[model samples]
Target: MQHKYLPLIIAAALSAMSAGANASGYRFGSQSVSAQGTADSNAAEANDATTIFYNPAGMSRLDGMQISAGATMVVPHSTFTDSGSTRFTHTPTGGTAASDYVPSQVTAPSFYLSKKLNDKWTVGMGMFVPYGTKITYGNTWTGRYALSDVKLESVTLNPSASFKLNEQHAFGFGIDAEFMKANLGQAVDVPGSVMALAGTPNAAALAKQIAQLGGNPALLGTAKDAHGANDGKDWGWGFNLGYLYTLDQNTRFGLTYRSSISHQLRGSTVWDFSKVTTDPIVNGVLQAASHKANSAALVALRTPETLSANVFHQFDAKWAGMADVTFVRHNRLGDLDIQFPGTAEGAEVIRQQWKNTVRVSLGGNYVYNDNLTLRAGLAYDESPVKNAELTHPALPDSDRMQYSFGANWKLNARSSIDLAYSFLDFKDAQINYTNACNPLATACTGNGETTRGTFKTHLSLIGLAYNYKF
Candidate 1:
């Protein structure tokens, strides 16, 4: 597709901003097999057969029919304090707002299942979310022109199989069907006086010219407002490869690789908002112009690739331990492309300068009596987006640590229930931007402003598994 200038500018604006409070954007990946991994020494090592996601090759060690399902609900809070460098001249909500930011809460959900077929093969299917986030700010927010709210969601269906080649080795493979959707909104500055000048068919033309001169502080009288509305949903496919090795009667090792998937989002972009509310603009144009309410834009978002290795060790009769390390090629996130329709010249735009991230987890389980078991785990995940360029509200990202606890209760013989919960703590990070943000501007100035703060999250999970031994 040919690149369009306007759409690229908008796209660049959207990509530079890190999604704020929503997990749909940059939260930690969830675990559905929370029970199996929650148990003993293997607990911190391999955890359940769900290790297929954590370590696919590990599927070779399971016997009989093993099915696992669960979900993680995450709640996040964020705060921002502006630096002296950034300054807002006016706001629709009134006054020169100082120190702008918002806080958010949401639930990120996920689940999975697996079964062994004969002695040589095993088949499994899992349902889970891969990416998403949500961010919202008060109307009077200082950076209103830069951001307001962002929501993104991506889910996946994975079907997998494994083969045991010998007592010491096994291999497995899985294919992923991914579906994703996104919603974005932001505020922009337009001359309040232009509203009166936009009376005739010249509204669209005038709106374009005004947008070009928007960066001029001396010309900026009162802050007139506008919003960006876009939602894109589509599907893509990818694959996972895994291997497992048995070192001894009580020890096992596994590794897995998840390839990256690229998504092209085709959606509508709407620009709507009055030049001013009931409150009159003190200077500049007072008449608001009505332009085409909608436009079209496309976004190509990347899902990073991952490599993980794990070790499981069983000790005595009641305890097991497990540990895992994951490396993700998030550094590829350095920039994202946004495409516009053929009619919209300069179609492609790039945003963000993301870096790579890594994750590490340790867990353990204890067998108490015969029908009940206890589990616990800890993990740390790194962030790809840095502080300075962070813009979008949908993907509020930062490095985080997770502490999880769960258990299984067996009923009769073939039925059982699992319960799990996780606490996530995100390090506080800062954001800085200014009028220079408008890609259409030439001579944009004002110390790009800055905001300081952090975020915290909580997640909960509940599941049921049915077991049948042949």
Candidate 2:
């Protein structure tokens, strides 16, 4: 009797909360097309309405009503090569390693609007994607037990207000409302769970059957490899602050801070047991233990906060330069925990132990003519993972460099267009993770499995936007 339904025994590959963002950790990073024209170093420029995201105080500099809309295209490539991966039984996990995981390219969008209520006060709003990702690996990869596929996304809406205290000083505040969703999938070991029942009642017969069937290598885990998947969505809130200081008509400095947001993703877990052995004894025992069709699941997490500083200077009619620095408090993602009800192992944890990080950027602009301007920049971004030991298949992070360039076209006195491009290369890094099953659970099946491998990677971004002054 070949049965096709079974519950989970141990969830080794649980979650990678910070899995698929273009920026370090879970942030999309590129929020504005004009900003990307200078490698994202335009915080003090306040030339467009997008200032609502980077530095709201800059909004006070806008006249009348202004709006900006844009979109970015992100293409990523990820490949994995296994060094030494094994099953819970200490046997080699027989399978082909993944050459590439990210199936294709992705696109993100943004919009901003600002209204100068008076000479001293300005109000604005922004709707943009702050975090998002999409990556998939083959189901039979060497690290199948650790990660099979993952997709995550988030959107934030910000309503801001700014006050011009004087000719040289301005302050801004905003309310941040965000929503996030995620889905993660991985493979399960049914034979491993059966073996966990060894020495118990009616177990001698099952053991003999397993050993006899092992004679044919083709049937090894084919009929016993199950699957586990989880999906959920949630909403969170936070705040932001911005300040702009103008030392003179030719120079300006901007500082901004974003607060952290906490969220509890509520979802459910589904297990597939459609390929279990036909043996009644084998099927009955496995089904009778820790079996459930579905169960409630929850994951508690917090996004990180950031502090950014920037200076923009105009040297001449054809010369301008800017520099920016940002500090990310990624320590907020220390330990990620998940809860699953009606299971032997009711919960699982993936230790991140992430560290704080920094990003630095420099850029320059030149006016080729009255209606055209060219932009270029370079930036260095750091990852939060301390080392390979803490890296996971979900988020194989590393330090990287951003190379960017773009241009601006002023169509007329009230309208303009911006186009930018960037290429990012992450320093090579490794993933070293141990078995994730909690042996202490009553009916666990983890046998000290480990996944150690490296992933292939590539990233590029192209942004386009239109700005209007009404």
Clashing pairs in 2: 1-278, 4-273, 4-274, 5-273, 6-273, 79-456
lDDT of 1 by residue, 1-470 (tens): 11111222222212212332212125336545353234211322433456556655566667666665554444444455444322243223232343323323344444545677778888777666666554555445655545456555667788888888998888889998987767666544444234333454554554455556552322333445655556777788899988888888778887789888766667776655544433323122222322223567676656668777777787867987778777777655655555545332233333456666677788877788689887787877776666655533334456766677777777756656666666656665555433332323222211122332233333333333443333
Task: Please provide, for model 2 over 1-470, each residue's C-alpha lDDT reduced to its tens digit, 9 standing for 90 to 100.
Answer: 00000111011111121223456766788899988888888899888999999999999899999999999888776667789987776667777867557746677899999999998999999999887666576677887777677777778999999999999999999999988777777776555654554566645554455456543323323346666777777888999999999999999999999998877677777766555655544443444443534666766767888999999999999999999999988887765656665554535556677888899999989999989999999889888889777776767778888899999999998999999999888777788777566222444333245788876565878899999999
Q: Each prediction's TM-score against the native?
A: 0.77, 0.89
Best by TM-score: 2
Q: Which one wins on lDDT?
A: 2
After superposing all C-alphas onto the true structure, candidate 1 shows an RMSD in angstroms of 6.7
TM-score, model 2 to reference: 0.89
Compared with the true structure, model 1 gives a TM-score of: 0.77
